[model samples]
Target: MTTEQDSRASDAVQLAETTTQPSSVVARTSTWSVWALFCLSVGALALTALRGTQWIVSDILIVDGLTAVMWVVVTFFSGIVHSYSRRYMAGDRDIERFYARVFGFTLVVMTMTAANHVALLAAAWLAMGLLMAGLIGHVRDWEQAQAAATLARRYFLASSALLAGSLSLLAWATGTTSISGILAQADEISTSVALVAVSAIVLAALIQSALFPFHNWLLSSMTAPTPASALMHAGFVNAGGILLTRFAPVVTLEVAVMSAVVLIGAVSALLGQAMGLVQPNVKRKLGSSTIAQMGFMIMQCGLGFFAAAIAHLILHGFYKAYLFLSAGASVEQTVPKDAKSTDTGVSSVAIGAVTAVGAGVVFATLTGKSLLAFDSGTILVLVVVLTTLTATRDILRRAVLPATLRVAAVPIVVLSAITGYALLYNAISTALSGVPMTDAPTELTAAHFLALALFVVAYLATEFGWHRSSTRLYVFLLNRSQPDSSTVLTTKAEYNDV
Candidate 1:
């Protein structure tokens, strides 16, 4: 936003231009393909939703509104990304596997999002691990493909051990892995055992979020397709926050634990964001910012603001997806070098709006029952909505608009606004009523799924509406141009494809 920031942003653009073609998969123009994949992704989500809600988890667990909501968001975007890939990843070598891997990962995320037992967690985690490996290995070239596989495998292996360790600790003390049952007996886990499980889970989540010491995998993952990057940053990576959110009430009930989560989240948010500002890679910068924001959301959960955490997750997920898509479109395509001196033009205002909402998350955590808290949260939700709308505008303005998005954009935008409004209003009312916003540790008791329906609808609208030719004004609104050299460096490195 300042002169210094502007120069840094330009430098990032130059750097991305410099990375001719890394050993990565890029989807060239192809419509019918994206549509077909989008359909399958949606079907996968729908199936997962039905599976999560309509039946019991064998003899182990139950599914509720939270499961429903998580399924919807993950599924919707998985589909949207499918649609986006049609145009963005036109000439990719292994397009068939791209579709398969994405759809496969969609199911994996759905399973994880809906899991209510430790066994389920292990199952879902393993499935996701395999998919992560597939996604990384799908690239044709050895250097990139191998890097992806190796990083993904390490993530799987390490996180698997962490999952097993946490489960063993919880089972040893609580006697079962059912989330509901665990929460019911969370008080029985004695402080010592509780401390151990908390540490293991927290460490695991940090890995998933790619925070600080555990962030290299995210950087290494840049060699994947733009769509894969979109999925990782906007959808899957967010799962780490969801994990903390689901289990937060348990920790929050333990005062020391809650405070620790809050502190860690705040620190991660601040540090990750600062690092993002300096990274030149596009996807990397975005990924770092994601980790930071996720920390903010996780902090909200830690502070007993479960509903607000869900709000953050759902809102951020959409805009983040759009942004990844934007980056994918920019970098994957071979646009004329002399097309324009800088990216068309993007809005600082939109970025400002999203940042304001992130700030609201902090305020909400600090003043759960105060008017200031409610107002800040409301403002933050609107920032997300506005950015989604601006994204729609940008998408529509693109030289080659993806068909799936064009069809779904308007509704997605409208739905996002509606759901955002509802969540903000609910947050305000609950805070005003002096409700603490948490009922237990394992899951949100009042996670209204219909609201998630609204979230999915709004995103569909934006993806649909954003289909016009790129324009100077619209580009500026969406952050296509004008950044400082430092910001540019961070962003360029962030985006391997772009």
Candidate 2:
């Protein structure tokens, strides 16, 4: 009887262990499959770059500068996120499904980037939305994930339809289905056709980029796994900027469209930054930051700085990806500590302003332009200069450095960074000159000035209010930025029950 009981117990243990073997095998297979796909994508991108050949596959797919660069970004991020997910999601039962969805989304985005034909672009756009829906809802058992996925799917589908309409209009106007051909012949297209097409494109981009009111989907998407969040924020959100840059000629033709883009983008940027500051949750804060960055990128496109927008897109993509991957460690590292604060008085701001002005003057001189020109390029230079000065001022004020060295170091570092950025921007602009973008609108209207003034006023007010410790504004922003507690509790309960 004892021997019989022992054999029965062993058999039960084996049955329990073997039950999970199939899932383990499936997960391993999916991981290797994604690895292989990533390797092939990188090899192809490298080969295309080395050959400097625009490969046209049956007049539908074209591998050129834009496609090659974006392909490299997609593949690199996809590989990194996939590898990270393996460890981040180690114990999940749906690991295989998650990997499959990620790979599918990556492939769709790659195809979209390489598409040269209108039909192919539309198909890839639709496929991306569908695949992303699956990825967002990877945890199908959770109500929050399902709801977020549904919301995302709705917005994506709407944006996809608008993009399709824009492409159709462009093709109809240009009398060709080829993207490159349409862009090359943009000057020949009638202003009416260009206006309609460009408006559609801009509106579509606004939705896709998550400009305010339409940004809830992105915030809700935090219910997804870290890898998905990283991929979505870093890879998918930039699609709007890419679209605008690719069609710069058409979009920049109408001053109204450009003004609208700038105004909308400015509002989104301000609101996003404000919300980010108020969010208590780390991931939600990051999401808000992504929204702000995307707005800034789209605003660059509106300014006829397509090359700069592309640079920003790539840099922000990599930066956000790294942040998401390392967020867990960052939260722990940022734990509050007691440290003595120093009063730098108003000197830091004054110094920063001087440094910014000096850098801007130097940049303008280097580019053979006057500060009064105030063109798109000049604006970009000023932005870079101001950013550099801000960094320098923060360091000098916060760090315990010798006064003389601090004063000397700020100028050196600020000058060097500004020079480097200006040179890089010039090189990229020259390289992309083949892309037909008009010079910035030399004439500014009342509306344009109003938009700029609103941005400045909003920023100043926020800063002043924050510094003054205005309880009303702080409470209002804090309440508005976070989701309702009851909803969060419900989602948590559903997740745990699942």
Candidate 3:
């Protein structure tokens, strides 16, 4: 009788498992994600080596600090999202094609970021435009799919013209397309003419980065799945920043240029925060953050914060990638199968917490700096640190803590000591970054205070206690999945079978 019951239980559990078929879309996406990661890793190491030596490795075209770093960022995140897609995708279709396109797009953008020559850069831009279109339209069933396609076509049309114009200008101004070669002779170009020509070209690059004043393509791209969204944010959304960095050697800075950079950066940062604060959708909030952070990064470059900007770009890519793809696991839950990807207003506390912490870090950093000066340039290091914090927060929230602390346990003494040191570190860091006696008083600090207060307000808005309806935001929607009740039961039964 015992043996029969055990056999019957085993069949039922296996039946349950087999009954469910993982989404084909997820499987394909997962496979592609992994492949992109692998190939991008190779690209990163190769670019690093080439830049380190400043040598011509023909097949490997990466040549400068700014472009080389973007390439690496793209690849690094490609790997992360791919890794995440494996579990998240589980079972999906078109696996091979998904990776092929992702990797191909990544390679194009990576190469474009580092392309020293106008021709190569143009090629990369065109390819990126195509990739963007494909990513947005990947979900064929959505009504927005056609709109995404139209957006990509528009992007391609503008990018192509921009590429042609920029190339013509480069040839007219510098007499050569090679990056290092032009940089060497950049100063020889007439200052006024060069500024106008290069600005036009760089403006075209902005389409790729989704920088403000040219950000429609990004909003239209929300139809894509989570993995694709990750690629967009961390992999290539900062292409304009990369472009600025590479061309910095040649792009002559005048009063106009400086104003453009600083104002744009500050505006992007503030705009992102404002939009993000009010955003009803999770992915949309993240997308806005990307724009804001990227804005800060480019602004830093304008501010002449080279090292800091690169650090920010690298870290932001990884963290954004993780956040996006990790978010894939929840996409199915967030959307109704009936369609219309509506925001059920799930107050993602974790996301809000991370964002709050990020706001705090930025506030602290700005307090340390002097942005109020009349001739102040971009706040470079702070911008870079901003993205790094975002990435680190995601990694810690997803990969680090849950695996170690939540599912597992820590010794009492070790836990208490960590708490003590963390508090001490924060206190000191805060004191150091806060306003000095000599510094002018401004409202940025007050903004920080308001942000902290808002954090509390956002949490209270969840209103989980009010009610539960069909349209209600699902509890545990923002949180990651745990062992399903059936999985737990099945495992226990299997143990008894053993």
Candidate 4:
């Protein structure tokens, strides 16, 4: 009798599992559909490139560098996420719905990217938000997922409204609805009109990109499935960068607008990075990282480095997508271990400083470009130098290789990174050469220097406090991240008394 009952229970469990599993045929169909879309988008991108940047079909469609680039990125990543979701969400009852929503969102984003007229762009932008809500709440049974979806929709709605206002102003100023037309008349548009439009665009981009206080929705969105997370971080979050780049001509008209963007972006970057350090969950950590990265990208746009921002957007999209997709394996690799304290000796600090400075000087000399020639070039060199040095130091200190091999590897890695960045930057600059932009104002340059100095000072302070186990700042960050133990204990005691 006991054996019979056990067998029946096992059979019931298996049946439940099978019923919840996604249909193999449905999964295959979804994958193939995305693949077909990807192929079509790629072909369209090539055609657009061949025809040059212009409106097609009577200003109803745009075929420009931004459109071509974004189409390739969105379609490629959509296909990837679709294929990934087939396995990741295999047993999900809503797997079919998830796939449909992802495809729908991708289509809407593509439409937005290809929109020549402001009205079409506005419509597509709003549609993207609606579709995104469905994708975010794919697992509607979860309360957290539903809440995240709601929050995301709220932010997106506000963003859409601001964008609409900007578009209206542009249309009114230019006497035409065409994006190209408005941009062409940027010089003739009254300063007040341009300022209002540019300010609206900046505000819209900030909220859309999840900068600073507006970033909570993005942070809370990790409750979605892995594929959804990947898509959101890699594609959806990049909409602001795309929008700013598309309107570079008009946006660069006002120095004050760019300065505001820079200030907001700098704060977002700093806060995001700090908060990311305290997050215990891997997914949430990545979310914080995305906020920081988007902040930096926006800062680049504000500095009139639209091409550099585009490059950062594409590269970061691919990188963050891979990180999210493989996050499970990463979790396994991150089993808790005893923390080791590394002494930041004067010698080591000196070496790092020298390496960073030397790398920048070498790169500048090799490229035959003056550091002051372009703000983007200067900032890129500083970033690459700092990153390469920091990475080299970390690797060398942790690597188990022979002394000579480790020493050799450092230079090889640093040189390779510098070369790759130089080549990539050059290519992006060439591709976006037609886009009109201006040099950042002197005030903005001063602000950038101030922000950089603060970042460096903060880094040094953190390093100095690393060995102090009782550091107040460290404890505060940790406590803020963790649940309050006192509240939990008090609640338990009260329940016992009751």
Candidate 5:
């Protein structure tokens, strides 16, 4: 056998041995804790749903529809991650530390979600970032991991600081430290203070979500363990949407501010999709996709559909976690020799597009919204249509079934996806019913339409190979999407400890 083949075989054997070992005591206990928390969260959700009530404690912690839903989603994802990591990191020397940190991070994030006081919320947010940084640098012997951790920590710190300042300003302006109280008095806040506070919030959300200029941290964090990456993508990044949703009242105060957010999200989404297309690494590709998904989530918030944003984040979290955990299995195949047969014909592509459009119309009609009204919901419906079109076309291209079966699959898949999304959206909307400005559909401005136009143009350009014709554009995106220099290895010897 060739040297490369021998090396690959040896690595496979080592992986098998490592993954098959019995879980450590700490791993088992952590797994149990996560599952227990998940169960309790479900019960809490049921109570809230049945009672249709909101609760608060001394203005320090709040329990409402938003809190319950977040608790259920966060704990559910954390439980899955812990279970997966039991086998994935079975024999690592620092297994205990990993589990402990993961559990602590989960707790802190849950606390932040329910925190009613500004200080408690800010503290929890800060702690969440620190723990995630520790997870990224789980391997102390790896220099690259350390660098990645430091880079991520810096971004997280900046986000935390901005969040603190924004909250403080809002509190001072409104003379209230309680989140609900501050939001209730948002109308009394001075215009300058309101704009500044909300602008800082927008920046904080963008940074945490890894949108465009702030995306380097996530790209650089590829050194994190697969489980850590999964958790970060699944729960950590989604905090941006939660933050925006919590502060939706302040966000909708200024038309220009909301427009700015829409513009930022649109740019980030297009750029992220473009960059993900060029990524050669599997994990980094997933990271780029997370950036794009986060962008869409933030865009939903900017468009005034906080419930839709929450639903998108929850769905994206599950999808991403599954992808990360199964990423290893994705590399088992070699390039096929007869790839031409998989190339989709023009007729099939048209059918998929038509199906997606029809689904969008039905979705809009069912929601009792006009397609041309340019409401917040239309953007979401548009996003679904585009996503469905892409998925259906890809299925048509790759499926090895007979022509009849392949064509017939389009409507089934499209309908199922749209139906599922509608259910999730409605559930979230009900959960967020008491929250202010959550489902408030704003009139779209010229800027919003322009951003949509840019999104469509970029999507078409990327999809049709038009962007590939420009070397400079490709090179620019490639460079922008890269991780920090210090986080990349310069020699094989640097990877010896890995």
Candidate 6:
């Protein structure tokens, strides 16, 4: 080719690139702007919460404890994601589009948290789902990414439809389009209507949170970049807990329903953890873990402690976000290390059990809950104890400490974790004081006991490799844990450069 023609072609390509993607300076500016806005929103929410301000525009918006807490939590996470993405997503051809969608998603979620009108709530829910799907398929040229996005979009759409229908039914029955008003009149609504609406809501929450029988979407969504995945795992999945918490008054109205909720959560939590055990991929492992954590959060809601669910979600968000953003480090293989021995001694188990129980007692005392009470709080305390025990065992077994030091470290580590959790739990409970049924602990029913037994069995089975004893059980879990086929990459040859 002639020199003049080559120069002209290069200039044309540069012009096209300039038109399609924002300059580096412009992209960085937008990133910082969005992050700054989120920071400002957090401060505003904190001030509003501190001043005990509860603002409401009938059937439009409401700013109460629930709203304040969610807004602060969402904005804080969104800001962190934005700041991280600035560097993480650098050099992407569609960086501007990514930022725009993320910004829109964050705004819509914030709006949904404060939405009073059923229509507005439904609209925001739908919009956020679409935006997230777009983010998941940000690499539009990649077939696997496109397939993953389509698969997730279906789940999100189904969730939105269920939520919309539920909200409509509630509005129609209560003769109030306002969520606050509908919940206020929940008791007056007919049993059939309430049941149908809450059932839809439960299903919606399940799909959105990627709880089992509906969890493949999350697994498939690994096609998204790390930052988008972090935002999704951190903020998006928590929407289910937020939804259930927002509808706590109505959800607590039916015993049979709550029992079912607990059962589903238990099954999903166990299954998710079981599936996570078999996953070798780091992101997939994290995805499975998220499913389990969301299930636990839902279980908390089922136990009638929506405030605890909220606190659990907030903590999970921070922890999961960090894990995702730093996931690349997990792939580094500077030196091969020997796997730790799993031969935990009986003494370690005894110490772990004792320390865990003690931590649970401390948590209960700090939170004004009774460990011995035959109520939902008792069940929650038991869960805390079991979780702490598991964590204690892991730490003692993994840490390269002397036997005596390991024994001594159990109480110190477990107690510190429980204490910090209690403080955060108390703060969250206070922040959600205005929400109805935030801590409406119920009497221990047969169903509750059964669910707890199953939970304990699941944990022990996973810990002891008992689940692997049954070939059928292991295969079922492994098969069920897999993402959709189209979303899986079979070979590098499938790549098609833009």
TM-score of each: 0.61, 0.84, 0.61, 0.86, 0.93, 0.92
lDDT minimum window of 10 residues, candidate 1: 442-451
lDDT per residue (tens digit) for residues 1-498 in model 2: 699999999999886655544445555665676677667766765675566556678769877666766777787888888777766776677877887788878888889888989999988988887777778778877776777788888989998899899999989888999998888888888888888888988887888888876787787777678888899889988888878877777887788888778777766776777787778789888988888888878877776777767777777888899988888875754657886543255766666777778888777665454556666555555555544554566566676776656667777778876676557556555545445562343344554566566665654665365723877877766655664232253655666686
Give the better candidate number (3 or 4) by TM-score: 4
How close to the true structure is residue 241 of candidate 2, measured as C-alpha lDDT?
Answer: 84
Candidate 6: deviation at residue 356, Å?
A: 1.5
Best by TM-score: 5
Give the local distance difference test score of model 3. Answer: 0.55
Residue ranges of candidate 2 with Cα displaced over 4 Å? 1-53, 332-343, 358-372, 385-427, 430-434, 438-443, 483-487, 490-498
- Badly placed stretches (over 4 Å) of model 1 are 1-55, 87-91, 328-368, 371-498
Please tell me which model should have the higher lDDT, number 2 or number 4.
4
What is the lDDT for 481 in model 4?
36
lDDT of each: 0.59, 0.74, 0.55, 0.75, 0.87, 0.87
| Model 1 per-residue lDDT tens digits across residues 389-491 | 5444454444243444444544445445545545563543342221223422322222212222334443444344331333543443234222222222244
Which residue pairs in candidate 3 have backbone atoms (N, alpha carbon, C) closer than 3 angstroms, thus clashing? 24-92, 24-93, 27-91, 27-92, 28-92, 28-95, 32-99, 33-82, 303-378, 312-384
RMSD (Cα, Å) of candidate 1? Answer: 14.8
Kindly list the per-residue Cα lDDT of model 5 for residues 151-179, writing each as its tens digit. Answer: 99999999999999999999999889999
RMSD of each: 14.8, 4.7, 13.0, 4.7, 4.4, 3.9
Ranking by lDDT: 6, 5, 4, 2, 1, 3
Q: After the best TM-score superposition of candidate 5, give how far the Cα of residue 192 lies from its true spot, in angstroms.
A: 0.7
lDDT of 1 at 212: 50
* Steric clash pairs (candidate 2): none
Stronger candidate by TM-score (2 vs 4): 4
> Candidate 3: which stretches are off by over 4 Å?
1-52, 57-68, 87-93, 328-498
- Per residue, candidate 3 scores C-alpha lDDT tens digits across 11-74 of 9887656435344554456456556655665575465544444434563364433444454456
